[model samples]
Target: MTGYGLHTPIEYLKGVGPQKADVLKKELHIFTFNDLVTHYPFRYIDRTRYYKINQLQADLPAVQVLGRLISLGQIGQKRSKRLVAQFVDDTGIMELVWFQGIRWMEKSLKVGSVYLIFGKPTLYNGQFSMTHPEMELYNPAKKNIGNLSLQPVYSSTEKLKQFFLDTKGIQRLQETLIPWIAKEIEETLPTYILKSQHLIPKGLAILHIHFPSNMAELQAAERRLKFEELFFIQLKLLKNKLLQTNKFKGHLFDQVGTTFNTFYTKHLPFPLTQAQKRVLKEIRQDTHTGAQMNRLLQGDVGSGKTVVALMTMLLAIDNGCQACMMAPTEILAQQHYHSLLHLIGDLPVSIKLLSGSTPKKERKELHEALMNGSLDILVGTHALIEDTVQFLNLGLVVIDEQHRFGVEQRAKLWRKNSIPPHMLVMTATPIPRTLAMTLYGDLDISVIDELPAGRKPIKTLHLFESSRLRMFGFMREEIAKGRQVYVVYPLIKESEKLDLMHLEAGIENLTREFPLPQYRISIVHGKMAAKDKEFEMQRFVKGETQIMVATTVIEVGVNVPNATVMIIENAERFGLSQLHQLRGRVGRGGEQSYCILMSSHKLSNDGKLRLQTMVKTNDGFEIAETDLQLRGPGDIAGTQQSGILDLKLADLSTDQLLLQEARNLVLGIFKDDSTLDQPKNELLRKHLSRQNTGISWDKIS
Candidate 1:
């Protein structure tokens, strides 16, 4: 079938009736024939062979077999009948049991019959057994050897499984669709391109992916499919970026160095780090170009990305354009406002803060000032994006923690001006270079690789919960030296039903151990009102509270220079990135800071690795890389809610080489045929259109 003509709705497919098709549409989001074709398997299970029952071991996910049924019986009452059967092969004797369907098993089993049973083996009552094993009765007349082949396990809903539409049912559909696909779909790419790139034909790839005969065939099929997915995605994004650069003209801000130099020499309090200087230069170069700037600034906890952002904002002001900085939360917005106020205090620029908490009258006044170009810089949360708030001549929009905002919200910031504003995004989470290129290929990237002078490295250590007394002693010493401490717990409320420790109970215990008369302790959690939480955070920031007991809500944008000690309880429960963020809450001051990770004795290998990685390195990029390795790509970049692109086959951690190859291929192809309409590239266009439909293609034509 031609790509455009193969537009059959999924309900019309063979074996997928209306009812089952509805389930596929609702659960797997498969609504069309193409969607069903592209619904790839997450992982393939090799079921080509089985192990003898005697070779089974505990705590292993292995398939094993039993010999023949010697005796079969049903036990228990009518409502709770259990089927018990015994099997004795030449190697060993074992039992087979089923709890849900006793009558069905009695009808299927025969005392002297031999069968091949496949399942996870286990030890029950000091004897080997399998519960609810998949069974196939031996039939010499049919000469069937019980499907010792690789199986495709498609994701299905329980409702579909109840209707006998399980993995095997999906395999039947695949088998029926194979001949149609082979006859209808032609090989799109040239044979030379396929042979040189080591890619299989589209028809062969689809068939082998569902039912491959060997490992080599499966690997080749997977490579071709993964490459196609990533290649089209990169091509579409790069093409969009190229079009934007060529068509849109930007207001060049070339006087950035003059303003920055004047501020550094006369009004600046401290010098910039080498890494910061390099990133600032990159941003300046991007701004001076006729093309609009799209850049991402990544740095570690105290690598000084905010200073770079402030300097870039100054460039906008120097060019007679207004700038705005948007943060994710009210507390973070206020924090940025205070920091910028301190840095540009002596300059002639006017900085203002706006948030949902701002009074009605004050908000109106701020809006008026913003529209009149009186406020040189405005710092706020999503409140800045309200329709009532307008910019006089907005040129630069700086988004801190860019992952927190969605694409639509980020685009809305550009609509405030006639010309789209140049965007500079900042994030403290250091992304791996390959992932940055794939996800942010449209944007130039800069990494602040060093910290400022006088900033001390955080001392990290791991301890068991039994070392609480010693840790408290260390905290007392730090407090005695006029430094503060932060004691963080995992949960907010103490539920009597749960056995885990909570922040409220920990706070109570701390208050009893080190009474409030000796030291002031404040508490914060997600459940508290925003105003109360802000007030408590302010106390800690001002050193009015010596120690703050809180949950993970303070993991980001809470800077306390005097707070030199951080103690995280039950650290094993948190991911590595979260632990790193918590550690970042401290170590902002000139004084030496320490991060104490305390976990229970029972720790998994991943938990141990996370804690050990914390103790081994202070670099956020190293921590991010280790986190990706340990936890995969899901939690590191968050899920789709964080504006993270969810690639189907390419793993951002292990597929770096594949990503680079695909990126280079895209650049080469586009450089040759900008529109991809050359006769040699027509197949590529059809493949892209058939496979990826979400990417906008209007500009390409």
Candidate 2:
């Protein structure tokens, strides 16, 4: 065997010099042979079929043609110069054009020589022509040109092309690199798994992934590789969970005291939904297990997650311990404080709001209460993690909209007590189960899928700019019925490039239409000061304002049960998740609520699909799944910085079944051998150790 292996630097490869390797490293992050081998093609082109010149159609994908170059010349001035060639097949003639490589094409072409041309055909005026067609001299002796195998198309950049490294160039490098390491590659999975899953060997899968001989072989290669990728990730997450349960000790809350029973029996405002009851039971089971609870609470906007959280905190207080809830924004913190306060209803549990806007004197008193175990529950923004805000026996932490905070910030909250507190992070934005399994795989998840009783799903409608007057009339009608309305614009201020309506112009238009004394409108946005924004939100909440004009700043944490109308201006600029969240702002009250999505006539296909999806269903999970398909997992709520999303092949959108299978297989393996110390599990143990270099955040939730 040769000395070089997968670890060899890419520059030492046969066809790659230092300069070309540097470009590859910067453009495609290919620093080693393994990096290049694993940089699989996004797609492949069929090269076995050759289209006749006359059979070519307009706007068709790239096609291959065999023809003879009969004439070639340059036209136009230097700036507009283009090399044009007339190539004739047995049936007809077509023009091959190139605008960039004029001199090179002029020097390379020979008249009356048969050549192969491949490119997309475009119709200009009345004639079909190909621009920058790939040209090669036809040779009947070699079978490589028209082989049955598919041609790989690797992703490339203009900078890489400057060094003669485009898609075709990268394919050539793979051809040389794959064979060199194929023999040296080692199997990562055990023999039993490979046999049970009907997977090919690792070496053979890598070979076929780069250059498959047939469609079936390519699919098999993809299946094997995707399973491997997802399997290792599941193993890591499951192992983290196992280690957390075994290594970390948590403060046990083994009793339900007067506070929890009092609120449930008398002060509870409404009956709890079955889904909420199930989630509370899950939390209750975790808190008393003597293991630190790292749980994710997911529910739709009006699903009463806050009530479940309040009850969980009461359990902590009943055990002679303190509980704290942290929100990403000050507005959300205050909302939680008021919600909990109203729910407590003289239950003798102390709850206070501490945020950046809190006065110094109030913070001092709140700190004292917390240190002396007097503050039963504290709700605040990131301020709760401050050094001075210490709890006497911090037992539980509830983070609302947890994705908005960074990892280190969440870690700070976990480090508040000598023993890590029970963590129950909540999100109103629904996450698909596949995504939840991958992103929060380490955390135990409990979803409150059902909305509260007596709540109606928001009636969603899509409207163009022409329907503005009618929408205004409808808004006035709702306001006349003693219901508040919300007009959410995508832009807070006028933008030069965007022609959408801004909040300032929208407020002006509303004032002109509704007039002064009859309609009281409040304006709020991210740019407004904390107190001012809170005052405007409070006005809308209290029915003092008939209409509230704002940006997406009100998308979360602003709960106005009386606001029955939500009109989102330029709704096409927002994504499906954002649109769903904005729609959730309404539908909190018993009366039938409406969410009107207003946009210009000009809309992309994606924009249309998003609006249509919102109008079709109120199921946030379905909407979230569609959103995951429309926009991949990266742009979702919390998966952006999740290093696990750097998946090379496994698509979280389409690979749901595969992900589940992998997860189940990992579970089976762990059930048999938790430590992976058995002889049959040594491969997995070695692979996991090799990948365990990053800092473990399992204990911090």
**Candidate 1 per-residue C-alpha lDDT over 250-336 given as tens digits, one digit per residue, 9 for 90 to 100:** 768977556666777776656888888888888878888978777788888887888888888888999988999999888789989
The RMSD (Cα, Å) of candidate 2 is 1.9
Q: Which stretches of candidate 2 lie over 4 Å from their true place?
A: 73-82, 100-113, 139-148, 693-695, 698-700
> Candidate 2 on 529-567: residue-level lDDT in tens?
888998899888888889999999988888888889999
Estimate candidate 2's alpha-carbon lDDT, on a 0 to 1 scale. 0.89
TM-score of 1: 0.90
For each candidate in turn, the TM-score is 0.90, 0.96
